[model samples]
Target: MELQFLGSGDAFGSGGRFNTCFYVRDARGAFLIDCGASSMIAIRKFGIDPNTIRAVLITHLHGDHFGGLPFFILDAQLVSRRTAPLIIAGPPGLRDRLTTAMETFFPGSTRVERRFVSEIRELEPRCTHDVEGIAVTPFVVKHPCGAPPFALRLTVDGKTLCYSGDTEWVDGLRDAATGADLFIAETYFFDKQVRFHLDYATLARHLPELGVKRVVLTHMNPGMLARVAETGCEAAEDGMVLTV
Candidate 1:
């Protein structure tokens, strides 16, 4: 499978990067890890066809993490005229959050007639579910975004990928990332400890416990971006692609 960083910036668009979105595609099909507000723009910029995406697995309900659903769904219906079913899995209240977001973005948008079916699955913490072909296990994290945020473990095509989502140091991540092919972590800061955000130093201290094959840092602020070279770990950038 091939994973691409469609958008790698944090909520504030630090380093002039786009919001947090990742795209994965292989012989089976394609899916998205996170679809932030700028994901539509990033997808278009990367010349990706929205119709090919089978599912979107969200990490949390933050605008920079899940806000692009409104545009993605509307575009699929009005522009792509898609007929394939789309699976969206996330934390509890994801369905209601997307509905409110859609309506807030474009009034009465959810009630529109569409040729495709959009399925919403509210994932439970520690329990795994098969969404289309990807296996997803959500672990509750510390970010308080109306609904609970999650650190995710996803396995597909014999490759496992874990994401820290957006949180401080949490032991659950060790379980989520242990023996994974890739761990996409959120390094919001370089070394300064911040509430509800991970720092590079904190992640590094626990890296050995994770037992991850590879680590790619994402959702970084300016502080983290500036010191990425200091971390020596792979740092995600817009449009960077990795094959797993």
Candidate 2:
């Protein structure tokens, strides 16, 4: 299995990083963890074919995390002429939220017919859902996004990958990342405690307890970006790829 950081920045694109998007490819197929608003551009720039993505697993309803679906669907319909099924799995009310976002942006885009089938699956928190042979479990996290935010644990090709999607220091993270091959976490700051966001210092304090094989920090703001090297943890960079 291979993991690629397509966009590793915070919501504001701090340090010139793109929004939060990660591409995961296994023997079965390729899928995305979060399709941020800047994902389409980042995908194209990185020479990745959008059609190769079989599914998209969303963590929350925030624009930076879930806003690119509309554009991706439109592009697949109009430009790529894609006809394969695309699975978009997320928290409850995903279908409704995407429809609302589509209409708000394109004003009747949801009404347009498309060549491909867009499958929307509302994931039950703490329950494992299978997406095209990949197993994904969403664990509720502490974030106020008008809905329950999730930290995902994905199992594919005999490997596990965990993502701490935008949240403060939460005990649930230990369970989410336990025995995983990679733990992609959000370290928005170096040491300063912020509301609804994780800081590097707190994460470092609990690193041994998490017990993951590897930990890479993402969703960094300017402050975190500046001190990434000092944190002594691998920091994700846009376009960086890792194999496990």
Candidate 3:
């Protein structure tokens, strides 16, 4: 399996990095972990064909997490002229949130007739679901984003990948990363303990307990980015790719 960091910045675009988006591909299919507000721009900048993506797994409804769906869908309809079906899996009320976001961005966009089909699957917390042949398990995390935030564990082609999507030090993270080939976690700060975000120091202290084979930290602020070398884990940067 191949994992690509489309964007690895925090909500503020710290260090001029783009927002959070991870592209995962394997023999089964290709999918995006999170489509942040800058995701479409990053996809184009990185020379990725949007039509090749089969599904997008969203962790929460935050703008920096799942805000680019409208642009992506419109691009698929107008630019790519794509006819392949796209699945968007997220927490409950996904359809409503997406519609609201679309309308907020472009008036009447959600009602427009489209060439491709966009399917929204509302994922129940702690339930494993099949998304375009990939098995995905979402565990509810500590972030409060108007809905149940999740840390996702995905299994595709016999490989497992976990993502700790913008959460603090929660026990659910262990469940999300346990026995995974790669764990992409959000280390937003170096050592400062902020609410609803992870710190590198806290993660480092508990890394052994997580039991993941490899750890890559993403969604970093400027302070965390500067101190990444000291964290003893790979720091994810935009356009970086990893094969697992």
Candidate 4:
């Protein structure tokens, strides 16, 4: 499996990074891990076909993580003229959040059942679900949201990818990343102790316990990528690609 960093910046697009979005693909179809607000622009910048994305696995309802869906659907219909069905999966409130997002941004745009359509699946925490051919398990994390936050562990083609979706340091993180090929953890702050965001120092302290073979720091802010350390752990760029 190949993981592409579609956008690696945080909510503010620090260091000129777009946002926290990624594309995972292989011989099978491609899937988007997160649809951050700047994902479409970054996808176009990388010269990748956005229509190639077959599904989206959202972690939460935050704008930085899921605000790009409405525009992406519109772009696919209007600019790309895509006709394939799209699948979106997330926490319990995913359908409602996407519906509201569509209404707020593109009013009356959800009536595209005649054209392309989306199958939004709301997952129960700690429950495993099947998406297309990928087996995904959602784990709760520490994030202040109306609904519980989650991280995703995806296994496809015998490859595993763990995503720490905008979480603070939580015990479930070790379980989420256990025995994964690559752990994509968010590091939003530099070294300070923050409530909802992860920092480098805290991650370093917990790294040895997680037993993650390879880690890629993502969802970074300007301070992160700008002063990113060369400590064997890679920090994701706008177009960085990793094969697992």
Candidate 5:
């Protein structure tokens, strides 16, 4: 399996981090873990063909994690002019969220027609579902956003990849990522304890317990990026790719 960090920046895009988005692909095809704001541009910057993406898995409804859906859809429809169907899977209320987002951004963007069909699938927390050819399971994460946050465990080609999509210190983290090939965890703070996000020290203490073969710290702020030189784990950067 191949994992590509399309955009690894936090909300502010500190240190030139684009946002929280990743491209995971195998011999079959490619899918996205999160489609945050500016993710489309980041994908294009990587010289990737957006039309080749078959599915996108969203962790929550936050703009940083899912705000780019309308644009991604529109871009594929108008710009790429793709003919393959696109499937989007996310937490509950995904359809409503996208509808509201479209209405808020130009009033009729979601209603636009395209060369390919766009299907939105809403996932229940902690429940496993199949999207296109990818198997996705979401677990709850502690975040201020009323919408329940999630961490995804993706199984593709018999390989598992876990993504800690914007979460606090949740108990299920270790289990969600346990025994996986790669764990893309988010460490926003270096040592300072904060709500709805993990600090570096806390993550360091928990990393060994997860039992994943590789750990990639992502969704980091400027401070976290600065501390990467000292941290032992790999600090995610835009356009970094890791194969397992």
Candidate 6:
């Protein structure tokens, strides 16, 4: 399995990084972890063929997390002329949120016939669902984004990958990351106790207990980005790729 960081920046685009988006492709298929608002541009900038993506797994409804679906769909329809179905799996109300976002961004977009199919799959907390060929399980987390936020745990082939979407300290995270091959955590701060987000300092302290083989810290602000190197954890940068 292979994992690539297409975009690894916070909502504010600190350090000029793109919004959060990760591309994971194995022999089974290719999918995305989070399609942030700027995901389309990021994908294009990285010279990726967006039509190759089969599905997108979202952790929450926050704009920075799943807001780019509208543009991604449009690209697949108008630009790439995709014929395969695209799966969009996320928390409850994902269908509504996606429709609202689509209409809000490009008025009347939801009513258009894109010549392709987009499947919306709403995921319940702790339930493992098969998306395409990937197994996705969502864990309830602390962030409140007008709906339940989740920390996603994905398994493909025999490799497990976990991501602490955007949340503060939540015990469920430890469970999601347990036995994972790679755990991509959102550490927005370095040491400060910020609400609804994790910090590198606190997350580092718990790393030993998570029992994960590798950890990549992501979704950082300017302060966290500056101090990331000193933390000694592998930090995510736009366009970085890893083999799992």
Taken over the whole model, the C-alpha lDDT of each candidate is 0.93, 0.91, 0.92, 0.86, 0.85, 0.92
Candidate 1, residue 157: Cα displacement in angstroms equals 0.3
**How well does candidate 5 match the true structure in TM-score terms?**
0.96
Among these predictions, the greatest lDDT belongs to 1
Q: Which wins on TM-score, candidate 5 or candidate 6?
A: 6
Candidate 3, residue 173: Cα displacement in angstroms equals 1.0
lDDT of 2 by residue, 96-140 (tens): 999999999899888988899989999998888889999999999
Listed per model in order, the count of residue pairs whose N, CA or C atoms clash below 3 Å is 0, 0, 0, 0, 0, 0
Candidate 4, after superposition: displacement of residue 235 in Å?
0.6
Error of 4 at 82 (Å): 1.9
Per residue, candidate 5 scores C-alpha lDDT tens digits across 1-244 of: 7888898988888887787889988777998988998898998899989988999999988888898887898888778989999999988888898888878985877667678888898888777798987878888888766577888988888889898888777887776898889888888989989888988899888877788998888988878788887888888878988987
Once fitted onto the true fold, the runs of candidate 4 whose alpha carbons sit more than 4 angstroms away are: none
Which window of ten consecutive residues has the lowest lDDT sum in model 3? 223-232
- TM-scores of the candidates in the order shown: 0.98, 0.98, 0.98, 0.95, 0.96, 0.98
Model 4 poorest ten-residue lDDT run:
223-232
The pairs that clash in candidate 5 are none
Task: Evaluate candidate 1 by giving its C-alpha RMSD to the native, one decimal.
Answer: 0.7
Residue by residue across 1-244, what tens digits does model 3's lDDT show? 9999999998999989888999988896689999999999999999999998999999999999999899999899889999999999999878899999999899999888988888999998787899999899999899988989999999998989999998998889888888999999899999999899999899988888877899999998888888889877888989999999
The reply for model 5, stretches above 4 Å from the true place, is: none
Q: Report how far off residue 34 is in candidate 3 (Å).
A: 0.4
> Which clashing pairs does model 3 show?
none
Cα lDDT tens digits, model 1, 1-244, are: 8999999999999999999999999668999998999999999999999999999999999999999999999999998889999999999999999999999989999998889999999999999999898889998888989998999999999999998999998777777889999999999999999899999999999998778899999989887888899999999999999998
